[model samples]
Target: MLLNNLNNDQGFRNFYMNKRGPIINHLCFDDDVILFSSGNRKSLKRIMRTLKTYEDVSGQLVNKHKSSVILHDKACARRIDRAKRITTMKQECFPINYLGCPLYLGRKRISTFSVTVQKILNKIRGWFFKFLSVGGKSVLIKHVLQAMPSHLLAVMQPPKTVFEIIENAFNRFLWSGSDGNKKLHWSSWDNLSYPINDGGANFRKLADISKAFTTKHWWKLRTKRYLWSLFLNTKYCSRIHPVTNKWRNGQSHNWKAMCSIKVLVENNLGWIIEKGEVAFWYDNWTDLGPLYKFLDPDSKPSKLRITDAYQNGHWNWPACGYVVSDFIKAHIERMQVVLSDKPDLPIWKITSSGKFNIESAWNFLRNSRHESNIVNALCHKAVPFKMSFMAWRVFHRKIPSNDIIISWFKLLASPNCTCCRVSQPENIDHIFFQSYVASSA
Candidate 1:
């Protein structure tokens, strides 16, 4: 088959070369065809007839529907109707589907062509998904659902209860996992981790409590009668009030805090001791002895004092200052410090006089080598900011490439790409040149 294809390609090339004088370029890939020529309409018609004859002899009929003929000029190539041929010479416009994209003829700019191409491609994709089965339909639905507005999604309310939500999510999973007509095995609700029988009593109790809480009578009783209302409200509280011995305050006091700690010890011992391996720390405290033993072996009175000092505040002290942009600035600062100290470094140097413009300093360092050591150092430090200005200077300084201007306009127009939601400094390679799945726009 490979030999046959090679011979066929050679034969076609030779035939076009020998017989067609006006044929400038021709390309064929398997059954697909693209032919270029610098001939008048009469000559092109003659060539087409000859090709048809050859196809008839070779038992490969030409798909005129898929074939096209355009005059050799940028305007003609741009104006040619790829989908439907122009029957009249006066017709200035035609429609074509180039590379699975519908394009209107007579578009003067390449940018417009690209936009039209993308639109048609998306339309084709929509059509393809529409023709698919229930499972495929569900996938498209999921995609659409993800793209929907958050407010609209909330209002839709597909599932109200936890059980209903779980059931709906499982149904979606089942549909996605199997193809059409293939059955999915679902165990009885009894076989679930929390069986319906066990959950029923809890659910009913919760429903009754919720009903009582939201009732007009409960609200009136709490508001109309002051002392009785305070007492009734006190029963709902989890914290013991300072003035009243009853649990009456909204905030969690020492007693409630201890209760929470007890619950954590009872419920999360496996997580703390085995998974986190905090048994060393757990052993020191009697109530939470196992957890303390796993967490810290030497957790005596002295170590507890240090731990209390560190854990006094709600948030961790070390992590409090570590914002996303701080990481980038820290990396840049570290690279600058390292490069300034190195006397013989090719891509960096500290002037006898200190100048503090970041861009200028970067340029001076970049001028010393093809590979920017400062930028490389920043990369080593795991900084997310790309050396975009340097890349722009290399690619767009000499030749005024509109691609670069378009890129700049795009970046300036929006900090984030429309498709992938990644923020700038995004390059053309990251946006369009790479795989579409990975591309930002």
Candidate 2:
């Protein structure tokens, strides 16, 4: 029975014992054993008797070590010892030179391990050169050859630095873009135009070459070559603008426009104009209050001041209030006709009513009647309550009426109602209800 199947049988040992015969020499279940002798019937009977006697006295079978075998031979043992000695000798003589150093391999007589190491180093060097392309291949090749050892001639050799490898690779192809013998034409004023015997011919030659290389014609011819080299070598060259002292191909139109405005103001009006005025004048010619102030403040009948509010906040403009007042007054006076006509327009329909002043009209439209009442009635409401009220009072210049306040609250309480939707949203409410009607009507 298979070892795994033995678990099902209760008397597996007894079953095996029943099957024992003359041909069977031994039986073992783990460490326990039974031995049989089958040389002759007489010897077998003697062995069986000894086994039975042993079972009765000690309850164990005969040990094979203590039992004698009739056919023990010396020749088989001698042959096995000789075969083991031969195998050991062959193992000792196995070739180790076949697996050389891994650093240098494939090109010369370096070890395999040395060849592999060299290959790895080459890869690293190549990556470095890919970023820093500066020199020629010959320079790198010379340095590498000098560094390489003399002994590694068969297995492999180290490659030159990445720079050299790339140079050599491109050198193999004849690039049409590369200049062969086309000499740059030197002008008569160039130093190189005269012979070296002349006093400044050498200096002239240097200057001429520099100018030729920098000139439009020569540059056009070499542009492709120079760009190609730059791409392959991963090197970049840059030029700077003379006037701006910045690296750029073209001037900023914004700066140019500003300069032009400054020049025009200085030449025509004898004034120093601000950048804002320049921009404003450029956008709309009639909107020239600031420009007029900059040009001839004395000539203008109205007092005018120009203030930068943000700059004043930072203490950048000291007389900001005066400037702002003057600038605003001047701006209004300049557009006096337009301002006077504004009231006649539909936009000032509320002002045309003559009941409420401009400030009152602004206040009435600024806050929803409901929101204002909610804040006034409930002191427990958030701080935004007092803040909103204060802002309206300070900016709009009037307290809201109770009717307007109650209507605002009703609108807020309504659900999905048109009056609520139109009036409840505060900014939209202020715009359509107040500002838009006043400005457009």
Q: How well is each residue in 1-441 modelled by candidate 2, as lDDT tens digits? A: 222232243432221222221123455657654343323334444444445666678776555443333222333554434433422211111112232323211232323234434553564345332322212322233244312322222222223333234333222211112223222221122221232222111111221221222222211211224532333222112221111122233433222222322322222121122322212211122234233344334332222122232232232233332233466445634542211111111111233452323243223222222334333433223434334334333333233333344454564342222433344322433544554453466
Cα lDDT listed for each candidate: 0.32, 0.30
Per-residue lDDT of model 1, residues 1-441, tens digit only: 222232234223322332312223445657765554434444344445566567777887766654555442455443454312332222223444444433343322334234333443353344442435443443443344222222212111111242233333333332333332333323222222121222110011111222222222222322244543444334432242211223324532322332322322222222111121112122221232232223234433111211232233222324322232454334423432211222221111133332223333222222121334543443332322223222322332322234454554563343344455444433555453553565434
Model 1 TM-score relative to the real fold: 0.20
Q: What is the lDDT of residue 333 in candidate 2?
A: 44
Distance (Å) between predicted and true CA of 230, model 1?
96
Supply candidate 2's per-residue lDDT for 182.
26
TM-score of every candidate relative to the true structure? 0.20, 0.13
Candidate 1 residue runs with Cα over 4 Å from true position: 1-30, 36-45, 71-111, 116-378, 381-441
